[model samples]
Target: MAVPGHKLDRMFNPEVVAVVGDKGPGYMWLRNNLPFKEKGGRLYSVQLDEKEIPGIEALGIQNFKSMADIPEPIDYALVAVPRQVSPYVLKDLIANKANGAGFFTSGFAETGEELGVKLQTQLTEMAREASFNLVGPNCMGLYLPKVGVRFNADAPVADDGKIGFLSQSGTHGIMFSLVSAANGMHVSRCASFGNAVVLDVSDYLEYLMLDDETEVIGMYVEGVKNGRRFFETLREACKRKPVIVWKGGQTEAGARATMSHTGSLAAPQAVWDGMMRQCGAITTNNLDETIDVMKLLLNAKRPTGTGMALLAQTGGQSVSITDAFSKAGLRVPRFSDGTYTELGEFFNIVGGSFQNPLDMAGTIQGSMDTLDRILRILDADPNVDAMAMELSAMFAARQWKGKPETLDKTIEEIALHKERSKKPFLVILHPAHEAEYVASIQPKFHAANIPLFQSFERAAAAFARVLGGGGRARTRTGVVGLALETQPR
Candidate 1:
């Protein structure tokens, strides 16, 4: 009994929400729903406890003795009662015809106990028979920022974001939203569906694939109950938009941990990797890589080929940049004869080299005009599909000590050039032990729609993934470029 898309839609953008069994210890679930209340969604509490009723009401939220007592229908409900008492509350929700519900109670099948397993089975039977949209028996569920629905109180409420995320772990889901938001990326919708007994990963994947608001989809999966269905949905999703997957339990030890964590049976590392590659989907190892890859896909221009042009401020940096990109399966080829001849006209050879990985060590530090000319030359080169520049945080700070306006103007000019150029441009700003200084300047790059990486390795890896996955660019209507013509490998 699969839940219909319209029901899921109403659940996601619930006009009325309720919290069942929220207590005073932390009042966590009730507090988590404050975002919905603040955003003009009607919120009610379904609590029978006499002592906790006043505290909940003190927060100005209307409290009802039961779901039936609520004046209106509930689009979504958060159930946080004790595990033993969950079935009763769920029955009440179903009797009231709530659209969907997410259970915060643990000690379900993941506990591996007879009682826990029986309880989960009972709830699954009930949900399936009634066609209820049960999100999770043990997970934080649904962070829809546009509608101000959140699992964590601190999650951002900005609506203008492009990333859609789905995860099996609540911690990863919450962390992804907060971390991505902090990095100037926002999630259109996020679901941490734990022990997905009723609504599984495939359900959400299908929903997001057609979501107009989501441009890119990110997944953090431990495993799936139906492999064929999940991959079918994933393959179709990749065809529509870029799908980045971070498989959690690739190792034996980690796989064992996942069974208890989400009662998932993770696939072998080789099988998972091969499947993702065959689906034309990008793969990442951890949270950082996932975010980095999404940032590149959303912000950077799509590379027509794998040829990269590297620029560095120091000789050592030039060597490292070339090595990093090359090792990541991208080529740092030589420039065309015409490109080299053009550079020879003004490129200072006394302290710099005019090759593919152009070493501008002592040449363009004093002249922004010279740097601009170099960028133009590279941008015009036929062999260069993409360009990357490496700068030290300390160098930037020292160079623009009192001329902050100059730095701003330079960044603006670079952004403009990127727009005009046919190739994609990336920047690698090394912290160089000046992390705070680097962080302070990142917002400028973000504001200018420039993708900035903290290291050459990260930038190169993310770029390689984007190119290797498919050279496609997502537009408001759909995907564009050769990516659509190519079949999954």
Candidate 2:
């Protein structure tokens, strides 16, 4: 999907950005770590220091003593000034007609103090009065790679992709986005709206629904001001695109953490679950599930049913995978008689069972050609809705091929069959400590858009998530833009 030309221009593609106050480590990191200097926009250091800010002048970053001193109009104002003077800097930004402001300074309502609350309320009123979109009073605002808008220098710089994420926690936002990018789901945009004194979770959720670049929206939400509005927006969004939500706080202790972390009042787990079910939104418990879901949702083809075909390198592993699939609410139907007969023609079926979770140890040991043929048959089988290959190469003594060319050919064959099948194909590389070895060959699977997991249980769990979400309602054929009228200024 293509990004909306207008919204992209205004929100993300800020041609001129002003950073106010002492350029601390965060500000310096953002300035120093910008991925592209000659691309979309320019960043300026706004501070009292008249002396040149080091290393910025060469990278298209200009220095201005104040926002007023800068003659050119600023698209966005990043407030990192001292707490007492932040209000004044914001006033100057408004006077200069800046379209948006992202306050990275803390000491807002999160402190749970009357003064903090008053300060946050004051900032919110200022934004409303000036008709400018406020990101947060105490948060890392935007991390958009397309326009070089990033808050953390250490975060991954991924080429813009389909996933769009929002979080109420700054650290979680950075962590999840980086994790998602490394796992092949490149995030188009990510916002950490801490305290949410101005634009809340609902606003971002609604915005992402219209973002043309966003095919899937993932959120790490602590709380919301208006539950009904949040759920309503979520339900409408789910109808158009997939919305994956991870509610942060469920227990009393966790609720306290949410309150302290973002000054949010987290709802009960039961209430949150009911709301998610009613809205048809996918739910996640922790960060691992969040990443797992995104990896599969972005890459795997949507399935119409839950009939899974499991193939493992060993019989015991196959049994474990079959059990996991069954527990995950997926069907492991017995292959039709024709399928059994077809398989018998390919291999000596003396010891191998022809049912679901077919053990391919003998076929793999015998010939890569036979294993490739079996995969093609399973891929074309109408009874199989999804295919899973659980492998423990460390446990197997058989070598499928001694040369790189032969192995590449085999991988190519498996990839082609998986592609033609138009269903989720999960490859489980087991043994947690042997992940490094698995990682070496993981790219072969990822290159074909197949999901690779560390365990049989995780593979089945991800498949179950895909089935629960119903996947994207429509195939993304073209860019889907959000209506311009409702877009934030």
Best by lDDT: 1
lDDT against the true structure, per candidate, is 0.85, 0.73
TM-score of candidate 2 versus the correct structure, residues matched by position: 0.89
Q: Give per-residue CA lDDT, model 2, range 1-489, as digits (tens).
A: 334554334666577777776454345634633564557566667767644465345555777776788877777667776666777877888888777777888887778888877887788888788877788877888877776677777666666578889998888888987777667667788888888876788888887888888899999998887766776788788987888888888789998998878888877677777667667788888888888787778777776788999997767777898999899899999887778889877664566666787987776664667777787788778888888886665653124224556546656766666677687777777755555655666677666666768777777887788688645343331211111112111
Worst 10 residues of 2 by lDDT: 480-489
Q: What's the TM-score of each model vs. the native?
A: 0.94, 0.89
Best by TM-score: 1
Give the TM-score (vs. native) of candidate 1: 0.94
Report the C-alpha lDDT of model 1 over 13-48, residue by residue, as the tens digit.
Answer: 789999999999678888887878998999999888
- 279: Cα error in model 1, Å: 1.1
Clashes of each: 0, 0
Q: After superposition, how far is residue 206 of candidate 1 from its true place, in Å?
A: 0.4
- Listing every candidate in turn, what is its Cα RMSD in Å to the true structure after a full C-alpha superposition? 5.3, 5.2
Model 1: residues with Cα > 4 Å off, grouped in runs: 1-5, 471-489
